[model samples]
Target: MSDRAEAAVRVIEGSLRKRGRLRDSHITLAHGSGGKAMRDLIEDVFVGSFDNPALAALEDQAVVALSELASHGDRLAFTTDTFVVNPLFFPGGDIGTLAVAGTVNDLAVSGAKPLFLSCGIVMEEGLPVEALRRVVASMKRTAEQAGVYIVTGDTKVVERGAADKLFINTAGIGVVPEGISISARNARPGDAVIVSGYLGDHGTAILVARNELALETQIASDCQPLNGLVETMLRACPDLHCLRDATRGGVATVLNEFAQSSGVTIRVREAALPLRQEVKGACEILGLDPLYLANEGKLVAVVPAEAAQRVLAAMRAHPAGEHAAVIGEVTGEQAGVVVLQTVFGGERIIDMLVGEQLPRIC
Candidate 1:
C-alpha cells in the first residue's frame, strides 16, 4: 500500500486506543480486506454500535420466528429498501432511521402491519466506529416506534476508497390485514385525495443538510414511520380506494402513478395543498418545487367522498398526521396524467420526475 493507504490504516487502528469508545478518525482501505482489519472494524464499529440480541447472534443470517403463521394464516407482505444518502446524518434522521422508516412505510402503504425487519449494512473501513454506533442505535429506536423487531442482520466492510462511509439495506415482512385491500390501481374518479401531512419538508431538509448549507430558517426532515397513522385510517375508512407513500419521486410522481394505474386524472388544488412555511421558502430559494421533493413519512390516500371526513379525522388523531388535509380530487379526463389547479383557476400538468433532483437521497 502507498503511504496514504498506510496512513489511513493507522488512523483506523488508532481509534481503538480504549474499549467501548471509538476516538474520531477516518476510514482506510485495509479495514475491508477480510482479515484482522475487517474483524476489528466489525467488532469495534458495527457490533459495538448495534449491540442487540439479533445482531449479537453474529450469524450469517438472522433467524426469526413467525408466530403469525399460526394465527393470521399464510398471507404475508414483504418489502425491502436500500438507503445511500450522501450525508449519513441529516437534519431529522440518519440513514439508519430512513432504512427503518422506508421499510415500515412500504408495508403500511401496502395495507400490511409490519412485524419484523432484517438489516444489512455495508461500511467503509476508515469510518469512525462511533458514527456507526449512532446510526445503529437510531435504527433500533425507529423500529421500536413502529412496533417491529430487528430479528436478523448482516454487516460487511468494504475498502475505504471503494465505498461511501456507510450504506444500509433493510427488508421487512408484515401481515396483510383481512378486508383491507389497497393498490395504486384502485383509485377512481370522484374519490377525494387526502395527504397525511405536510409535503416537501423531508426532501428540502435533506437537500439543505447534504449541501452543508443552511437556510434562513432551520429546517428538519419529516422522516418517520406511518404504521400507526395508517392503521387508524384503515379502521375509519375501510373502503379506502388506494394508498401510496411519497418517497423519492415525490407527490407528483405518486399522483402520476395513481392516474395511470387507476385510469383516472388527479386534480390537486394548489391552495388546499399543505406546504410548511419554512419548506416553501427553502424550495423557493433553492429553485426546487416542493411537489417533486422526496418525503419519508407522509402518505396519500384516495377514498370515497363520503368517508373523507372520517378518514381525515382518524389521520389527524395520530401525531404523525397532525397536518393531514384533503388536497385534491380524482377526475375522469386525462387519464394517466396529474393536473394541478392553480389559485388563479388555471391548471398545469404534474408529470413524473424526469431525472433525479437529488441523487442518493434515500
Candidate 2:
C-alpha cells in the first residue's frame, strides 16, 4: 500500500474501534465463550486501558519488527511467572502488578533490557467484573511505568472451586546487549553481596493485609519494577557476576543459589543487613527470619570486590535502589554454603530454605 493509502486505512480502523461495554456486574462462563461477551471484557477492560497499537491489533499474537529488537541488543532474554497471591489486591500492588513486575524483574536480573510482555489470566466463574477491571487497570499502569508493552494475552474461566478468584501469568521478553554476560554461577571468590533495598516488605505487607498475623503497623509491598535500577548498575560495572531478585525464598535463598552455582562460600554480616523496623518487628514477633521473607522490588547482586563500592554507590543513587547495602562477601572456603557472622560475634550457617516461608507471596 502507498504511504497515504496506509495512513487512510489506519484512520478507518481507528474510527471503527468502539469502547467495549457489558451489562453484567459479574463475570460468567459466557464471558469466556469466545463470543461477544468475551470480546467486550477484553476490549472494555483490557484493550481500552492498555491502549497500544500491538495490543489493539487484537490478533492471536503480536509481531514486532526485527529492526526494533536489534536496536536494543544482541540476545533475547525470556522469562515467565505465575502469580496467585491471595486477596487479589494488596497494599502497594495487586495480582496484576505482581504479574508484570515479577516477570520483568526475572528478565532484568538476567542483565536484559525488558521490552515486551504477554499476560495470561485464569479467573473463577462469578467473579465481579469491577474486580477484573481494577486488576486489568493495574496491569496497564504497571506495564506503562516499566516502559514495556503488554502485546498479547489469553483469558480463561474455570469452575468456582477449581481455581482461586484469579490467577495471572506474565511472560516477558528483553534484549541482552553484547559483552554483558551475567549468571547465577558467575560469582567470584572475592565478590561482594548486596541488596537493592529494605527486605521483607512484600511478605509483611501481605501478612498485614491478610490480617492472618494480627499485626497493626503501616507497611506496603515494595512492588516496583527493577529494570531501570539494573540498567544503572550495568552501566557502572558491566562485569557484575550474578543478579537475582529475592522473591519466593528471599535473600537467603538467592544467596544459596549463587553460592552453589559459583562453588563459593557467602559470608554475610548480620548487622549489615538493612531492615525496615516494621518488617523486623513483625518477623521477630512471629518467630520468622527476615532474611527468608519475600521481596518484590529488591535484588541481590554479586559484584567483584573492586567494583562493589562503585556499583553500590550507583545503586544507592537510583530510585529503585536508594536503600541498597552490602550485606556479605563471597569466599573460597566452604564451597556452596552461606555463613552468617552474627552481631554477637558468633557464626552460623544459613541453609537453603526447604519449605515455603510465605506461600503465594509472589
Candidate 3:
C-alpha cells in the first residue's frame, strides 16, 4: 500500500481505540477469561467485523429460522473443517479464508447452497491484535463472496508455547435443492470426469510460501470460494453425479473416493490434467506428483456423457473455472480403481497417499 493508504488506516484504527474500544495491542490469556477483556475482544474484533443481525444478537447459539432454510431446499448439508496452515497469511489467502472457504466448498460440492457458518478460534498468547482483526476481516469478506453468513463463533486463548500463532475451525450449514442428489457413490460408468481449473496451486503456494525449498516463484494459492462456480455448473448440469473440491489428497484422492464408493473405475489422462508451469516445476524439483497435490479453488465433477460438454462450457464461462477441462471418464472394467493415462503413453495407477505428502495444509 502507499504511504497515504497506510496513514489512513492508522488514523481510522486510532480513532477506534481512542473511543475506549479494543484497547489492547496484543492478546493475552485474559482475553479468554470471560471477563471484560474477553468481551472487548469478542465485541470489537469478531462480532464487530462479522456484522450481521444473527451474530449481533450475541446469544450462546445462533437461531436461524426454519422457513428460511426450507425456502432454498429440502435437506440440510452440514460440514465442519479446521484450518491450521503454518503461516497466518499467504499469497492469495490466509487461515481465515481457508476456514470459511473449506467449509463452504464442502457444502457446495454436495449440491447445497451454503447459508451460515460458525467460527471457533484458538489464539496463542502474545499474538498481535491486528492479526486477529485482519483474519476476522478476511473471514467476513470470504463469507460474503460465498453468499453466506458468519452467524456465531467462539474464541479462546492459549499459552504462547501451547499453540501455534492461530488456529481456526469453521462449521457450515447449507440447503440442498430438491431433486439434486450428488454423492461420491453417484458416479457411474461412462460418466465424464471434469476439473474446474489449474491443479496443485494451493499446495504449491504453501510450499513456496515457506521458502523451505529456497525456490523463488510467483505462485499464489488458488483459494477462492468455489460456491459460485458450483452453482454455475449446476445450472448447466442439474444431474451432476459426483462432486468434490479436492483438498488434502488433491484430485487423485477425491477420484479414488468416488471410484471406491460407486464401485467403478475412474480413468484420467495425465496430459489432460491442468497445471501451472510453476507447479509442474516445483513438483519435479520435489520429486512429487502434481496429481496428488492439493487445490483450494478447484473442483472435480462427474457428469453424464451427454451433458459433459455443456457443463464444461458453463464452467469455463465462469471466472472460477476458466481452465476447466474434462480429464477422463468412468469405466466398469476395474472397480474401485483410478487409472491415469500418462503423457508418455503409459497407464499408471493413482492411489491414495500412504502418509502425509505435506502437513499443516488447510
Would you list the C-alpha lDDT of every candidate in the order shown? 0.83, 0.91, 0.92
lDDT of 2 by residue, 1-362 (tens): 99999999967754564543666898888788898678777877888888899999999999999889989989999999999998788899999988999999999999999999999889899899999988988888889888999999889988778898899999999999989999999988889999999999999999988897787888999998999999999999999999999999889999999999899999999999999999989998998999899999999999999999999999999999999999999999977999999999999999988877777887
lDDT of 1 at 162: 75
Please, what are the lDDT tens digits per residue for candidate 1 over residues 1-362? 99999999878765553244433465555555666555565666666555567665667676656774435435689889999987899889989899999999999998888888888788887788668778988987898899888777666778757788899999998888677788999988799999988898878877787664466557788899999999899899877888989999999889999999999999999899899998888877778888898999999999999999999999998999999999999989877989999989999999999977988889
How many clashes in candidate 3? 0
Report how far residue 164 has shifted in candidate 2, in Å: 1.2
**Which whole-number lDDT from 0 to 100 does residue 253 have in model 2?**
94
* Model 3 ranges off by over 4 Å: 1-20
TM-score of each: 0.87, 0.94, 0.94
What stretches of model 2 exceed 4 Å from their correct place? Answer: 1-17
Residues 1-362, model 3: lDDT tens digits: 99999999978865575345687899999999987678778888887788888988889899988999999999999999989998789888999998999999999999999999999999999999999888889998999999899999988999988999999999999999999999999998999999999999999999988876668989999998999999999999899999999999999999999999999999999999999898999999999898889898899999999999999999999999999999999999887999999989999899987699999978
Q: Between the candidate structures 1 and 2, which one is better when assessed by TM-score?
A: 2
Model 2 per-residue lDDT at 22: 62
